[model samples]
Target: MKMKRKWTPSTRFMLIILYFEFIKETITVPCPASLHTANDVKRCPRNKLEWNARAARLNCSSINQTCVDPSLFEYHCVLNKEGNQLLEVCAPSKHIHEQKCTEFNSFGKLIQASVINCSDALITCPDAYRSTEMYKYQACYDVVYQSTRNEEAHCSSRSTEGKSHLGIAVGLNGEVKCCSGYKWSNRTRLCEKCTPGYTGPECAYSCIYPYYGEDCFKECDCQINLCDHQLGCTPVYWFNNCPHQPEYEEPAFTNTWKQRRDFR
Candidate 1:
């Protein structure tokens, strides 16, 4: 005794659209933090499929690739689980070289004075004061082979006894502080010996047009604004065999001659 609802063409089309949307939501791939940035797609094959193919052809695999640029954190090529497509992964670098132990005080002391590896790791000591013998609680390790091995660095009063002129050192805040004579380099992670014509703590200052030597101490002897850092202004006459002209003279009337000939 109730009237049945009739299905219209428009209603059926809407139902089909909703069904596809549900399917898409259920089939999405997962992205990992170690592989992609927040703004990027949260799954493998972050780049265009074409680009990944090119990278794979170049043998850019994760096993052999390395990140050397200080600006970029890491990068490598990888393949999806299906092994039919390759993907390139990259991340930004971070300032994490100075790592503090979990249980140590700011002054580099243990909170509970527990045994090695029992309480907390020790502070990373200077390279000069690092222990030759291996220990379980040391916080230092060689720059290479960090994953497979870890070594401890022992600290001593001698660590603070270096001469300022001898070499660069790590400051109290773990920043690369230059010695008395050296300058800090913005292009590098440590203090550097600035080349000639550059100055300042950051070694970013350069000598102006006329100054050319270490610390801009030497001045160019050539024409103004024309002097070069390595080679100064060129000579007017470069040929050794070129004839020298006589000095000019004022023309004057002589007895029978028209005038005195000028020498040039």
Candidate 2:
């Protein structure tokens, strides 16, 4: 049999480096032209295209003409998945707020947008609905390019902060605390589903009384205005006066162990 190759510390380090390099390539690489859907989009064209035949057909000029020209590099049309509306906004590759507007069909609009550096992307749910996922966007600094002899070091960033829990802190500046309605889960590393009796962004607001559970779907069967978010209904004993248990007191110290045993 051939000898088994042993892994050295240097070899392991090199492997890790290669793995990261591969991921970087994956993220930086442009999405295939054929892949048009915005579902979990990750990459965009590195350079602006001279002309977009697609834009001529889209005819977004009346609403926002900038939606089509790929040469703009930062402009891309965000097609509403539920509707036909297209929203044109500035979201650079490094500043992309992923998973925020998954409901909207990105329509391959992964090109960077024109926005101030390190800006937050706010995404709110529609009326009568609260989001269990999607949090306020926060940008974190990352080295875009390492220093070289001729060029100085440069940095890039992304608006997608860790954890989708609302109102959580971004980056290393402070503790990552989930909102009241949300609990941080170590396994998923994201704020999970709504907790009992709580819903809304960062768990800031509670479900109306008599309605509890996620999105206030569960109805309470208890008395009026007595329902709890998690427990459903308030206990009847809480309103009634119950007999109090007599306080226990030790018997007078017995003169001897036998006396104490007899008293017991």
Candidate 3:
């Protein structure tokens, strides 16, 4: 006996369904030529073309991981995800910055010859000295030094008095010498000229002229009047003139003489 064929709903569905799928593996290409030097890479036109071709072979995510020679046309090399090298030419570095010196000297001025190193900075000494006068010295920052033998001798003379040899000697310890155009006065520490109304050392005392009392406290006694009642009189003009009394008649003497003669 022949068997009867039966069709189910799952069988009909399987017969009607048809689908297709395809997959391809990623590809990586090697760089065409090796650029030995920056100059060689720049001169070759194939360098740029091969660089682009290598970049195209890489994945989109990793297209910037290549190394190029900086000296070669200022270009940058980038790689693709497939590990291919690329070259990108860029412009040279800009000249927007410049360096400058910290100090300058004028014409006809001399600079010193020295090197000073301080902190992180370097300083060069001037080529010539600023002043060539006698007893002058160079002053640079914290350091002070005498420039000549005369200055050194002057300094030694000051040292004997136990004073500094710098710009100016100060305090009570320094003595004023006549050679220095000054006379010492125990009272004032500064140098001064003799005042018109005063004389002697440091002009401490007043000159004897129209002034009379000590330190010229008393003014001249040349007033028009003979005596000054306000300050009493001096020995030279002590007594004032006396006033004369009024004259009277002589009537008593004649009667006395006549009475005496009659008694005799």
Candidate 4:
């Protein structure tokens, strides 16, 4: 019943980036040759156009220059403790042959914030992180994967998050909760109805007899398919309110009875 912060070291909370952008950063996709923030990357003075900043990718990554190899343009995205703001994008020193990436741009007065040493999953979920907006979980995965290739190590699912939301995937929408097992649909950005053949909190249960679909919202016709037990019994001939109700009635024989009685 205790609440926990979804971030470790607190400073990592600054990296709430987009999903695609986060993936690009983790893979070290070099910045484009031309940038709105910095021009002339296409014609670098030192052939160092690969030394690009992460902020350019904060919104967009469209560019002409091919992404440089991480071996060639490795950099540490530093964070300045100056109120949890991004410090600098410092690349490998031409002198240091080893690959110990420096964090802060200057690495002199600034403290080295670690990209490792913490699992974001262990942290408490922020409003934005809980909903997966701004690629919250993916950002954590990027950092954790750097230390250990095991992606599951930093997965949010491993954490016991706001279960009180009752499996409801958070988002900007006012939707409070959803059934268990089913997550918020990335495309729709909403907790869609349970998938066909699944129902209940998180959509863990399967559709019985008739209901089917991503959320089991569809109703089945009793002809070839059986009705769902929840919909009540659908006897074989019960269509259109029993259209043949009078067909099996016994016929009256008053004329024959009268004739037979007169003869007797």
Candidate 5:
């Protein structure tokens, strides 16, 4: 018997006509060179011919050749994405020239100048470029010239003495002493001593008393002997020549009268 078949809602269906419409609409649009040429002037005889015919007649060999005569076209020009001429001409390369002027600290010394051209620019060194103070400038067609200055060396002063900080000297004991100035005191490092009348750490002040005169050369004023009588007397001198006077002055008898007769 012919039974009734069930139709499920999940069953898929194909639409060939609709798929073809979507594919055609999604394709990329091609450039219309024919329409582009119509907007240009027809004055040139070369423009009237096809690009391939013009290239063959010109005998162009390079693959990078864009046209029969590149000179006729701007060597440097700006164009839009659709191959339409936006700007007539622009800089071929975006580069500029930079110059540096250098001189030595001394005017007689020689100085060097370095220049670097990164773009289509003209660079030149000034007369002062070789001088102690150099002035360099860079220029372009329409741009202003920029100047740079520097210095070089000519004459300089150098120390002839070595790096040692000590001075040699013969000590009183015949030993070598590292002295700096008048004083032979410093045993380690070189240092200056007190001047004719000065003393102290830096020999800055004048000396007093025994240490008097220039560099404390005067003798001290202190007494030499504690006792009044002495052989070596400095300011004053005295003599005591009583040799037997000590024994005569002995206190043996208290009162000496007629001795009360030896009657005892």
Candidate 6:
């Protein structure tokens, strides 16, 4: 005789599959080419035949035409998974960009990283990437690279002394330079002060308390007497606070067993 098997509600629920639902519909959704209903767009030819065909067709590569995607590297894609194909995601089609990584903070930094296409996004780089900052300090920096997610984010170093947010320090000649004394902070997107003991504003300022003067690096001298920072330490003349005041002379005291007991 065959024994009848019973199915539990949990077991039955697990075996059931929802009908009419496309598993990949959410993930395989085709991303638009340029993010506009009808932005300047032309399907980039994926094959060698279509390589520069778009530019050639539009006559953008005629030297006289000012086309941004002459090489068709800045093109975007749309996909169709019905059978098999490529254009579902939107990103830079740059085929020849140097691979270099830079670190950024969660404060919305527009950092750059070496990407073999944009598939290798540096957004999740826990380490192995850092902006042109000397030290992470309080935080990294926030740089506004692209205005939208589809755009490329650029590295920027704004001086902590000036705009401490969403920008980097641009030298007088428009070059990236870390503000002196101010180490670049990845978290705050501003040049933050050095380690503890540093003075001046919040970031990169005079050295520390003990060390004063230029960059707060020069230390004061204590000399023979105890170093009373405010009183006689460095260049300031050594002046005793209690000069020749009354001298406390204790009278001779006789040790007694009764006095010892009383003191205790």
Q: RMSD, model 2, all Cα superposed?
A: 25.7
Q: Give the alpha carbon lDDT tens digit for every residue of 89-203 in model 3.
A: 2212111111111111112111111233122324332332211110111122212111222222332223324444322223244543421212444454334444344433234
Query: Cα RMSD to native, each candidate?
Result: 22.6, 25.7, 44.1, 24.5, 45.6, 25.7
Best by lDDT: 2
Per-residue lDDT tens digits for candidate 4, residues 1-264, read 999867765456456455555554343322433122221110111112212322223222332234453443333233332212222232321221122222332324222323332233444224211110112223433342233223212223211334322234332343344434355566654555554556544455454333445454554554323343344225453555544322333446877787889999
Question: Which wins on lDDT, candidate 1 or candidate 6?
Answer: 1
Hey, what RMSD does candidate 3 come out at? 44.1
Which residue runs of candidate 3 sit more than 4 Å off their true CA positions? 1-173, 176-199, 202-208, 223-234, 238-264
Q: Write the per-residue lDDT of candidate 6 for residues 12-93, one digit (tens) a residue.
A: 7665543223232112222233232112211223343333232233332233212233442232222221111212122223
The ten-residue window of minimal lDDT in model 6 covers 134-143
* TM-score list, all predictions: 0.22, 0.22, 0.14, 0.17, 0.14, 0.19
Candidate 3's error at 46, in angstroms? 99
Task: Give per-residue lDDT, candidate 3, residue 141.
Answer: 21
Please give the distance, in angstroms, between residue 90's alpha carbon in candidate 3 and its true position after superposition.
97
Q: Candidate 1 — which residues are off by over 4 angstroms?
A: 1-176, 179-190, 230-264
lDDT of 6 at 135: 20
In candidate 2, the residue pairs with backbone N, CA or C atoms under 3 Å apart (3 or more residues apart, or in different chains) clash, namely 90-113, 91-113, 92-112, 92-113
| Model 2: lDDT of residue 147 | 13
| Candidate 5 TM-score to native | 0.14
What local lDDT score does residue 216 receive in model 4, on the 0 to 100 scale? 49
lDDT of 2 at 179: 34
